[model samples]
Structure formats: structure tokens, C-alpha cells
Target: MTPSTAEHPQMSVEDFEDLARHAPETVTLEFINGKLEVKPVPDGDHVTIFMWLLRQCMQARPDLDLHPEQGLKVGTYRNGRARPDGALGPVGHFAGQGEWADPAGVLMVVEVTSHDSGTDRRDRVEKRDGYAEAGLPVYLLIDRDADAVVVHSAPRDGRYAEITAYAYGATVTLPAPLGITLETEGLKDYSL
Candidate 1:
């Protein structure tokens, strides 16, 4: 966790949300670990990867919807706000819910890495912790930089206790509740 001075976040979470609300449409904002981060607009390859995964999820679990770029309240206190590339949940799970919906029934969050300076901390560390803290069942990181698929699951005590990485051609089995097997050879076409 990023330490705060005087136990004060750079700005209150509420303040961050207000600032985010007024930010320009081109700007994507995320508050993680008491810090504000501008998420880079995804590149073509990033979008392609997400779309590819979206199809897989839809085919495997027709009952669930893989929502694109959905805002979510993360962290144990719901203080952190994150807009994941895709949030998988039961159909209509976000209905009647406002912009920043609670993460309660969200089964999995997917993040396709953007080639950016902040991808390491933003996707691999801070956001992972935030999603884990929210007690979501799964976190899937399609790491373009590493050419690997990382599955984060088994959230326990504000962190994911089980993390596994698979190579591009490997078949990865997402655990129960999200029991979909991914044939990741298709990912290689999008890799650098």
C-alpha cells in the first residue's frame, strides 16, 4: 500500500469521485491506494484483446454479461473507484445501479494491459489489491507486455491468495463460479 502522510490520502475518495465526474470524456480516472491515476486510453491491440475475451466469455457463459468499461466501487470501504476494462457478472447485475456500482455480485474483472508507463503499478499491483479487497471472486489480467495470462483468485484478507500465470498457448481453467477454460493461442496474434 502507498503510505499516506498524516494518514491522509492525497485527496479524499469522495473528492476524487467528484473530480472524476467532471473530467473530460477523453480522460479516464482511477483512484487506487490513496492516489489518483489517469488510465491510458487503450491501443488497438488492447481493444482487440478485450474483444477477443469478451467473445469467449459470452460463448462460455451465456447467462453472464461481460460489461465493458464499467465503473466500480473497489476496496473494503468502497472508497476506491476503478473502471475495469470488463466486469463479468450475471445478466442485468448492474441494472438500476448508478455509475459506480458496488462490486458485490461482480464475479470477475478483466484488464488488458495498455502499453503505458503506469501499467505495472496500476494493473499488476494497486488495482489487483483493490479488486481483491472488494472480495470479487476473480481478476484476470491479459498481460500483453509479458505475453501471458494471469489469473488472480481466492481472495482472502484483502488480497488474492492464488495467482497463476499461463503462457499464450496454454489452456487456462478459471476456477469455480467462473469455470471457463480459455484457449489462449488466439492471444498470440495480438502480442507484440
Candidate 2:
């Protein structure tokens, strides 16, 4: 059975869109199990790593467009909304509609770690299942505190079986369609 909006009662897609349209500065929204929830605003460290990683991906592949913190509609269904820290897909507007991202068309989704205790678990577990359900081929996790990267792949049966972790100074190569590599050594210089 699929989860419903009741699972997270605080928000809904319509409510979120209203906020996005009327009050975008209020908070960042993410839909989890059919309900909308606010995501924590990224800190300075988060921005530093995000921009650096974006640059890395852009430099390696000049053809694709990589966006930082772009909202997405999952499963061709309006119930799911996700704002990947970094989202990469085809280089064009949405087909036919010129709206929400094409889930099946995307190559990868990335999330940077949060200092909140529950942040890692949510991104690693809840979001892992969420992304897999959407058939996103690759998910990358950037843990700034640890100065490492975690790459999850092979989404089978609504879960990923392969997870590779890279520590500081290591070069992490992204999976197919992305073909980007992240440099870890410089991440330590990022301020909170």
C-alpha cells in the first residue's frame, strides 16, 4: 500500500504550491508520503559544498544542466515533491507541460548532510526508499562533518543494495549519465 498525506499532516501539494507562489521565502517544502514537509534551510557549509560539487559536475559535462535545490514531482504523480540538493536531468524544459521534472528522465539526485541528528537517517533511509520508488538511478550523499561521500545504487525491489562510501581526499565517481567526480580534500575548508 502507498503512504498517504495523513502520514505527514502538516502540509500538502496544493498548500505547498500556494506557499511557493505566494510566499516562497517562508520555507522549503518537500513531500513525503503524500504530505508536504518543510526542509531545513541549508547552512553556509552546505552552500559551499553544493556549489563546489555543482561546479565539478558542470566542468566535467558541459552538455547537461545541473541545478541546485530544484523541486521535483515524483512518479508522474502530483502527490510527491522533492527538492534535491543537486538535481541533474536532460537539458530541456519538461516535455509537453513545461512543468515539474521528469522523474524517469533524471540521471541523478544528491543530498548534502544536515547537522540535525535525524537528518542523516531521513536522507539515508526515508529518502533512499523514496528515490528508489521513483526509479532514480543514482543518489549521492555528502557528509560534510565526516568530509566524505556516500553513493547508493542498484535500486531493486524498492531499495538499494549497493552503497559505497568515500572519505576525505578520495575521488568519488558518480554513476552513469552523470559521470562526474567529486574532490573531497577541499571540503574540510568549508565553514559552518
Scored by CA lDDT, what does every candidate get? 0.91, 0.73
Clashes of each: 0, 0
Alpha carbon RMSD to native, model 1: 2.0
lDDT of 2: 0.73
Give the per-residue lDDT of model 1 (tens digit) for 59-151. Answer: 999999999989999975888889999999999999999889999999999999888888998899989999998998999999999999999
- Candidate 2 Cα errors over 4 Å, as ranges: 1-12, 75-78, 93-99
For every candidate structure, what is the RMSD over all alpha carbons to the true structure, in angstroms?
A: 2.0, 3.4
Query: What TM-score does candidate 1 get on C-alpha atoms?
Result: 0.95
* Candidate of highest lDDT: 1
Best by TM-score: 1
- Candidate 2 C-alpha lDDT tens digits along 8-91: 445666776666656467577676665555678888888888888878887888777667776777632435777789877667
Flag clash pairs in model 1.
none
